[model samples]
Target: MFPTPIARTSSGTQIAYKIALPVALVLWLLPLIAVALTSVRSAGDITAGNYWGWPTSFNLLANYTAIFENTPIGKYILNSFKVTIPTVIGSVALSCMTGFALAVYKFRANLIVFFMFVAGNFVPFQILMVPVRDLTLNMGIYNTTAGLALFHIAFQTGFCTLFMRNFIKAMPFELIEAARVEGVSEIKIFWYVVLPLMKPAIAALSVLIFTFIWNDYFWATVLTQGADTQPITAGLYSLNGQWVAAWHLVSAGSIVAALPPVLMFFLMQRHFIAGLTLGAVK
Candidate 1:
């Protein structure tokens, strides 16, 4: 059974919930608040060990500007876009077709094959790093945008398929049957009917995958090298001088790098909520 909502709970419980909410929220946001504070603090503030304290000076514009002027952050951001966009498109596209087949078609191996895709999600990706790296090296795409994007696409397809298959399976079979009676081909049925209906799911999944790939520092570092090929996640690590950590610049870059996914979630918030809340999917 689901837990009772605060509105339906006893007055004492409701009061506790109200009191706890802001406390928890502040606790959650403490680190982000620190980062934002750090991003604007002058370099002297950082050098003098002023972290988690009042800034001696604010270099909001200067800190932000220095990242663009002094580092390859712009290129790293561009590289993140290149990898993330293609991975989102590729994984979502593949999942739609595979989802339709696994959801609608009746076959002996359907569940088994579907389970195979689902099973991939459970495997620890860390274990596969060595082999996956070797795979890219052997394929001659190591340290390239294409290789990183391709790897993300493949790894993500498993989860995307699981998300989409359950969504498609919940769609009314009568719709597909209606299309067949109207002499519509399967491809058209999928393209015009199912795909049109899948917009919410696509939007939600795109946002999720975009956020995942964009924040993927682990894979970004493991699969690629240097600023030219690395995403903003890894590129943030490169913001330091040889002898210095330059935490302020890294914090500034962190703020810059976080903007896209935050904007993405806000833009797709409507569709993303709808996709998750649909009765069938729920």
Candidate 2:
């Protein structure tokens, strides 16, 4: 029989820790739980000052349907998808190539180029906001999903490149050398060898980028004006203005807006963690 390893904490300490854990979790999730509960509550319940009480009835489906039917919530969600999917694909694809070049090739300017990307990624978005908005206007993609997506793709590329470069650097260089010894062309080596091993990195970046783009209210508002092109984040702000005291509907909309990225996180959890933990092992 195997003996269990006993934790040697004082009883008082264990009691304190046990008390603290639930408190901390409640604190962390309080807002989300509140919103969720609010989403199912009746508008009369809110008016009757029953904000935190048991819901009079579970009106989640009703609230969600009202949000879609009464306003352009569906359009906003569609816009979010339009912007998010392209940005994720474009940024990841561009970064993979850029990262491979920086990691594999030796050039006089390699470090300089990599540092520039790193610096750009860390810069405040406000610094680039004015210029990016102006550029989008000039390109005539402003007030459109394309404009927002283009900016996201360009800005996210800086961070994605850094991630990809570091990930590729941690890979075994011997594989590349062995392939080269067999006279495998550079393109074939990248397509067949490097890309296959990059699955974890790709998965990680895809989820991260999707969440970032989906949650982006600032760029969405700045680049796109009307409901026709505005994503859910920005649309939520506008809906908040129109809904006024309709807290139930507002809460429902917010949850609906937040669901896609949350679903993506759960669905790709393994790859996401693998990507984040890359280069942790020496």
Candidate 3:
């Protein structure tokens, strides 16, 4: 049997590393952990200034149930799903076509078009904010889930196109060439050849986009109103105002709002990582 390689570190160094790891993790997760703990506390506990202490009684279920029963949280969550799901599907579909066009074809102004997308992706949202809002209003979709989702799809398309183009560019060109020589149509090559290889990228972009759209308070507030149409992020802000010193309920609401993206990350972790690191290998 081969000898097992041993890691060598001084006791002092090992102790220092061990001490640092927990400290770093605690610092990174302090806000989230605090919110999670606060979610289970009773109103009296918070009133007694026991924000950081163990809960006097677990009220997690109560807090969550209260928000759903008393507030528009259910509507907000449904609106989020309405806006998020369609945006993901639409943006991905648009980007796939755009990316394929840019990657597979050697047309004039190709680099210029690609750079435009990259630049647009980095532009401040504020610059587009006013115009996009006006456009949505004119389209008669303002203050609606469809309006919010339409803007998200267009804006997110810039980044998605950049990602998809780069991903497709890194794929083997010979595959496309072989298919073309066999008289396969360009559309078929994309459907059968390119799309099959895009699973990881698709998964990664889906989760990432879902998180981005889900957490979008700024646009949600600006583009939509009323709990009937607003997403959970904006809904949370509104709830915070109403809850006042009810920290437990607020914390519970925050946790509930954050759960979908967290679950998505955990479930699709492999695809997420592969998608994120698409161009890192070369």
Candidate 4:
């Protein structure tokens, strides 16, 4: 059985929960608060070693403006979009088809294939970095947005497939059977019946993949070298001077780079919630 609801908990426990809530919230938000403060601090403050202290001057607008005016962050953001959007579409589309097949089809190798997908997710990505980088170089796409996107699509497909397979499996098989009984073609069944039902999952997965790819720094640094192909995560380093670290500007740029995903989640909040909770209640 599930644990008792907080509302029904003992008075002492309720008091403890009430006291712990704000403390936990502050702890979670402390890093973000520090970054926000740092973003508005003037460069002099950083040089004076005034980090985590009151800023001598607030340069909110100047710092934000300087990132675009002085750095290639704008181009990096565009590159991220170019890479992330395609990867999301490709991974989600492929996962849908693969998930549908694995969930619906009966074959001796079906479980084996699904297990393989699951197993791939367990492998440490760091271990494959060398080979993956070499492969990209061999394919003549090294240091390009296309190369990064291709790798992302391949790596993300397994998790997406796993997500989609379970979601599809949870769907009623009777619907598929009914479509077949009506003499509907298999392709038509997937297109007309299953695809519509998959909208929620698709929306949720898109948001997840978009965030993952957009915020990816490790691969961004490992695969691409400069602003020409770097995503915002890696490109932020361009703000650093040879002798100075512009922490304020870097913080501002981070806030800027984080906006798209935050907006994406908020805009799709309803759909994302529905997708996640679709099978939870019943």
Off by over 4 Å in 3: 1-6, 277-282
Worst 10 residues of 4 by lDDT: 236-245
Tell me how far the alpha carbon of residue 92 in candidate 2 is from the true structure, in angstroms, after superposition. 0.4
Best by TM-score: 3
Candidate 4 error regions (>4 Å): 1-20, 238-243, 269-282
| Per-residue alpha-carbon lDDT of candidate 2 for residues 1-282, written as tens digits (9 for 90 to 100) | 234222466777778878998999999999999999999988899899888888988988888899999999999999999999999999999999999999999999999999999999999889988999899999999999988999999999999999999989989999999999999999999999899999888989999899989999999878998889999999999999999999999999999998998999899998777666666877
For every model in order, what is the number of clashing pairs?
A: 0, 0, 0, 0
User: By TM-score, is 3 or 4 better?
Assistant: 3
Model 3's lDDT to the true fold? 0.90
| Ordered list by TM-score, greatest first | 3, 2, 1, 4
TM-score between model 1 and native:
0.88
TM-score of the candidate numbered 2?
0.92
lDDT of 1 by residue, 1-282 (tens): 378667888999999898999999989999998999998998888888999889988999998998899889999999999999999999999999999999989999999989999999789879999999999999999999999999999989998898899889989999999999999999999999899998878988898888889999899989999988999988877665431657788788889999999998899887666645655542
Report the C-alpha lDDT of model 4 over 1-282, residue by residue, as the tens digit. Answer: 367788898999999999999999989999988899999999999988898988888999999998888888899899999999999999999999999999988999999999998899778889989999999999999999999999999989988888899999999999999999999999998999999999889999998889889999889988998888999888876555421577898788889898998998899887666655645886
lDDT of each: 0.89, 0.92, 0.90, 0.89
Task: State the lDDT of candidate 3 residue by residue for 52-140, as single tens digits.
Answer: 87889998788889889999999989999999999999999999999999999998999999889889989988998999999999999
TM-scores for every candidate against the unseen true structure? 0.88, 0.92, 0.93, 0.87
